[model samples]
Target chain A: MYPTDCRYTREHEWVRIEDDTCVLGITDFAQNQLGEVVFVETPEVGHVFDAGDEIGTIESVKAVAEVYTPVAGEIVEVNENLKDDPQSVNEDPHGDGWLVKIKYSSSSAFAELMDAAAYEEYTKEGK
Target chain B: MVDFAGWEMPVQYAGVIDEHRAVRSAAGLFDVSHMGQIRVAGAGAQDFVQRLTPNDVAKLAPGRIHLSAFLTPEGTYIDDLLVCKTSPEELLLVVNASNAANDFAWAAAQPHPGLAVEDVSERWALIAIQGPKAAAIVAKLTATDLGTIRNYGFATGQVAGKPAILSRTGYTGEDGFELFVEPADAGAVWDALLDAGAPMGLVPAGLGARDTLRLEAAMPLYGQEIDRETTPWEAGLDWVIKLDKGDFIGRDALVASRARPLTRKLIGYEVVGRGIARHGHKFVSGGREVGVVTSGTFSPTFEKALGMGYVETALAVPGTALEIDVRGRAIPARVVPLPFYKRPR
Candidate 1:
């Protein structure tokens, strides 16, 4: 099940607004598909990127997937604990597994993301 | 589930990591029915098989098995296979499913009067039970004394009341058995084994774990480690080739290649830096590409990224430093002795 406060993308990334910044991580569905995550490559805290830019990479035992940003923003913070405990992404993708926090350019980009209800249905349809 | 060759198979049942550990610690069952079985029989069977393989076929007496390869006249590998000697006049060849048809066609085309080579793959299914507790679990179901079936040996008997060929040979490094049964009887035998092995922590494993287990054991996969371009000398499998065993398909060519110095040699390595060095990743030293990874995985038993690759013989020494080009970033690695994990004997 998806968290109600978070917005979702078809790429299986999730974002939740936290005051002035947003916390981003992959969704639970994405973790299940990736199997056991062995490594998570996170970007630097001050890196800037446009919307849809590749943020980092999540390497599982079987395959690798790129983490993409849904909204253009400057990275504010990155979770360094993931370097030692990559399994957290598969164990708790929505909370402790958050990859980075970003200061966004506009509030309109958040609205474009699907809410919990739409995301659950969207995942059911699949690409 | 995914399609492997033409058969639909599970990549995992519980999970790859969990299943891999199960095989290492307790027990694991694998439905490997996709492997092909070819039978060679009749008057000239022994002589025909001896002339076809490099390994000493004379040593493969009744109920014995030995790993051998079908070689091209150039001394290159056609495919690696198991020669299961059922009797002096009959032998069962277990081959990779991907090369089953081609291997059959090649073997059948050879001119050998009074010899019968038939592809019995369609009628057979293979199931493997592996780990420390595999024998005890299998012992409960059958009357055939498990002790009599030595390693690399097989015996035909009833399993779960169905006729089957139980061989004490497996792809995983752990001690195990591979059961060859009629397709119709496979389901019952599989269920019986799982049910019997359940209390001992045996679970159904898949192709994903099978690969990791074999890699940890340093077993060479056909296409990845050995191919037409690779000779047995380069693959670290020259021990299987017996030139003194008399004339065979690739004997002369093997003798010629053995005399030449090896250009590349297979080596095992552990990733010193983060990131798994996957298949086809290039190994670089001082900005020059020196090798290519054949197989790699995050081993559950060791909990580190380990891989196998072929490097220039000069750089194949253990403790030599190299870098694996994973994506665009270079990850530091070091050469080590083969078989990242071995069972405590």
Candidate 2:
């Protein structure tokens, strides 16, 4: 189960607000669906990206998928620990699995994302 | 559900990685009913099988299963199958699901007099219970003494109050058993095994986990690591072929072919980078295409990537430098001896 404090995107990424910056990570559902994550290519700090831009890549045992930024922002921090321990996403997806921190264009972008209950309904609808 | 060889089957019940870990650390059950089963019975059954396979089928004792291959005239593999000698005049051949139709047709067309052949795939269902805890779990539900069942051996027994054949063999490189039961009782037996073993960490595994486990064990898959154009010697399966066996299908060709060294040999590779190599990927050595990947996957147990492919026999030695073509980018790889991982003996 995901905490209600974080906002979710339709692609299953979750954004948690911390001070003026927002931290981004994949949802538990996304990690579970991908199986064992063998490697994670996190975007470097100081990299600028627009909403829905490809920022990184995640490779599993079976295939590879691109991770996209949900909001326009510049990367302030990247998860360096993921390079040596990509299974962090499988072990603790919400905490240590945080991928990057970005300073968004506006704080109101959070309102455009789904809340926990809404995201639950969205995932159920997909079934 | 995922489509596997024309059959719709679940990749996993809980999830693939979880199921794969469960199989490695504990135990997992698989519903492999989609595999094909063919029966050969008649006065000339033994002679017919000996002529069809490259292996010496006449040497098999009752209830023993031997891994053998049906080959083409040019010594190319038709299909790799398990031939069980149930009686002097009766044999059961189990084959891969995707090759059932072609294998059946090929056998029917063979000119073996007084041999009766029948396709029994629909009449039976197969389940594989594999892992470290497999023997204990199976022993609880079956009347047979699983402790005495040696590897590659089988016995007729009762499971879940129904008649079944229990074989001490599995795709996972662990102590496990494969149960063959009546099709009508498959679902009940499956539920019974899960109910009895759930508390011990048993889960319903699927093809996704199966593929990863087999990859870790370095088992070859048909259509990928091998096909009609590949010979047993080239695929590293010469151990199953008996060249001394008098006159069999492709024997003359295999004998004549062995006089020359194999050009390409299958070898295992461990990926050293972030990329995952997949089927049809090219292998580069000294800046040229030297081989092709057949089956590759990230090993769940090792938490690293591994693959099996055919390379020039000269470069088949372990520790040879190689590169895998991943998304058009060359990723460094090295030829390693199979299997990439194995349980302590």
DockQ, all models? 0.67, 0.46
Clashes per candidate (backbone, < 3 Å): 0, 0
Q: Flag clash pairs in model 1.
A: none
Candidate 2 chain B worst ten-residue window by lDDT: B336-345
True contacts kept of 2: 0.58
- How accurate locally, in lDDT, is each candidate? 0.92, 0.87
Give residue B319's lDDT in candidate 2 (0 to 100). Answer: 94
Q: What's candidate 2's DockQ score?
A: 0.46
- Residue by residue across B1-345, what tens digits does model 1's lDDT show? 888888899998878999999999999999999999889999878889999888888877899999999999999989999999988799999999888998999898888788889999988999999999999999999999999999999999989999999899999999999999899999999999999999999999999999999999999999899988889999999889999889999888889989999999999999998888899999999999999999988988889999899999999999999999988889999999998888998
Off by over 4 Å in 1: none
Model 2, residue pairs in steric clash: none
